[model samples]
Target chain A: MTPLDFVVSLALISVAAGVLGSLVGLGGGVVIVPVLTIFYGVNIRLAIGASIVSVIATSSGAAAAYVRERMTNLRAGMFLEVATTTGALSGAYLATLLPERFLFAFFGVVLAYSSVITYRKRHEDQLLAVSNDRIANYFNLHGSYYDEAEGREITYKVSGTKLGLVLMYIAGLVSALLGIGSGALKVPAMDGAMHLPMKVSTATSNFMIGVTAAASAGVYFIRGQIDPIIAAPVAAGVLLGATFGARVLGRITSRTIRLLFVGVLVVISLEMLQKGLFP
Target chain B: MMTRQSPGPDPQKNVTPEGDLQVSGRHRNLSPAQVAAMEEKIRKIEFAISLVLRVGVILSVSVIAIGLGVMFYHHGDYTSITGHASYKTLTSRSTPFPHSLGQLRRSLVHGDGRGIVVLGVFLLILTPILRVAVGVVSFFYEKDVPMALVTLFVLVVLIASFFLAGL
Candidate 1:
């Protein structure tokens, strides 16, 4: 396709991905990249470049609303950024050493595995944990929220600092090697291990992604992988999508939507394996 | 805290259902302070809603602007505009009109779309994984750590994905 055609198509994809990502809080760039590269025949490097822009665009955009609602734990995110960024830096460095085939194979496997787990936990039965932590205490991570359903104030804490940091390290590695946000990793670590509530995890993860991306995006940039042409639109589109998604988050059943999204990932992972093996 | 619940008719539809329009049917003995406190609570919720609205608007605008900017630059090619030390210069091989932009023209060139595909795929897997973190952060902010911790379990598969897929 002509560059114009490519960009126009990309815009359409961005909106769709944004809607999907925001609706599910999964950010479009992650899904958009695979679709562009594996299905549409776009180059992965170009996809990453575009996804970077999209990442910034979506997170920043969505973050605005999240912050206003007091849902986004900006401080927690910024503080933990220390660990996540460090992990991402190391991952980025490691990515250069791994063979392309290995990287591709590895990413494909992660997608497959996550999809299965998502399928298993696609319900409202989920709960949260309220615990103590030096990091959370020092950062004043404990806070209260107005639960709209209960029409009452529900306060919580920033538990599992050490565990969260460990997950962040892994998250950083994946992000660096794959150009994906470590939020997936970070959210679970904080929420499950530390017993944080879901909203805090989601918002905190959103707040932290930029730093994680920054850590590795720079590495990728230096590796001559960040093509502005690609990065600009994807990033812009993702940003838009993310912002829109955040605004509408309250309007939809993100949990259910996310579950369905996991199903889609399974197919994607399988396709990647098939192609990788066959081609 | 989001005081602005969905615009549904169920529970949080209106902030003040009876502003000074008190019902006299019940004993007409309710204290003014009680009524005033309820109204005050609603007002606080309204303020929270307003704050959320403000943030939402900015978020949407930025997303669109940034997405389009990236696309436009990508369409035009950032090499010509950013002028960063690393941008690849556009040559006849990479650009049809190598000399059309005069001084703003890109002088270096080389790109691999496969790299983009790799990046995209990597990012695709990342969204869900990273989203979990955001969910946790949101929980903490909302003082809903209970839910946050439960959702954290979702990361098990994400972690599995990392090791199994090598991401």
Candidate 2:
């Protein structure tokens, strides 16, 4: 293809990636990796390298709006980073050593498990509270939220701190390995296990995933996994798209966006399974 | 064919807030001694984590820059995968390392479905190892027994899944 043709094709795909990523609260890498690997016939390593750049773009763009709205739990995000960054580095090394088939099959299982989690929690959007351990209160993990529906800023403590960290660690690892942002696991873990509000968790997860991705993305980059020709446009496009998504957050109900998120995950999971077993 | 917003960061405003500046996990108050102790511990940990993050970010950027640099430095002389532009043919006609790297890249970028399928599987196995490390890191830092045990569980599941998949 001509350079112009390549630019146009990439531009079109970039826009689509940004829009979809913003909508689902995901960095575009998951979708990008697949399309590059399968349809475009791009190598997985190059795709991951490009995807990491995109991940930074989407996360940085979205994080700004979330912080402005006071939705992001910055403290929680910072606290969790201690775990994720370390995980990301190790994940990259493992990816380099392991063969490709094993990676795909493993990803397939994760996809299936993620499907079940999404399926089980399809409904119910209430914030439940429980007692926190000494650490939760000691760390000031409690906060108030202005629930638009209830017309009040409800005060609540973050429960299940232990559970949330465990999941965040997993989220970081999967994110590094699969080039996904891991908001799918991070958000739910924060919300259901930790009993943090959905809005708060989503915003926090967005803030955190980049650091996680960066940690591992760095390793991949060093080992020569990323390609700039792809990473540049992809990152730039995703950053723009994520900005738009963050802007649209309150304009529409989160429930609408969430169902769409689940649907996308379902499709991704099925695709992974099919490819893993068949290929 | 689609783009994701790639959710993340921009530096915060210069102005400081009246209360806890960031306000995610700030507790109400503590005695001077308690605060000092917590501050010390948190500080120590934060520096380590920050070092890791900075290294990661720097390394990731450098890699991409190198790739771009290589492409540009060779631009006028660059070859495609096919025809007169064929990088493969040029490499075949050229010397050793570039030829092999090009071949590896060709298999990586444009190989069959089976190649990508294998890559995906590798990503999968690698995740658990990564995840377990994360869990252990957090557990040790936080010293939370429950979280540490749960990390073990995730580790087990990851291992079990890998073996079950016959990998």
- Report the C-alpha lDDT of model 1 over B36-70, residue by residue, as the tens digit: 55445545544544454344434444443444454
Q: In model 2, how large is the Cα lDDT of residue A255? A: 62
**Stretches of model 1 off by over 4 angstroms after superposition:** A99-118, A125-130, A147-153, A257-261, A264-279, B1-167
lDDT of 1 by residue, A77-142 (tens): 655666676676667557758775565566568667766665676564244333436556444444
- Those runs of model 2 whose alpha carbons end farther than 4 Å from true positions after fitting are A96-103, A145-156, B1-167
lDDT of 2 by residue, A40-89 (tens): 66666677766776666566566544433555665456556655654554
For each candidate, what TM-score against the reference? 0.60, 0.62
RMSD for all candidates, in order, please. 12.5, 11.1
Cα lDDT of model 2 by residue, B3-89, tens digit:
000001111211123433333322233466754665465455445433443343334334433443444344544323223443222
Q: For model 1, what is the alpha-carbon lDDT of residue A49?
A: 57
TM-score (chain A only) of candidate 1: 0.82
* Model 2 clashing-pair count: 39
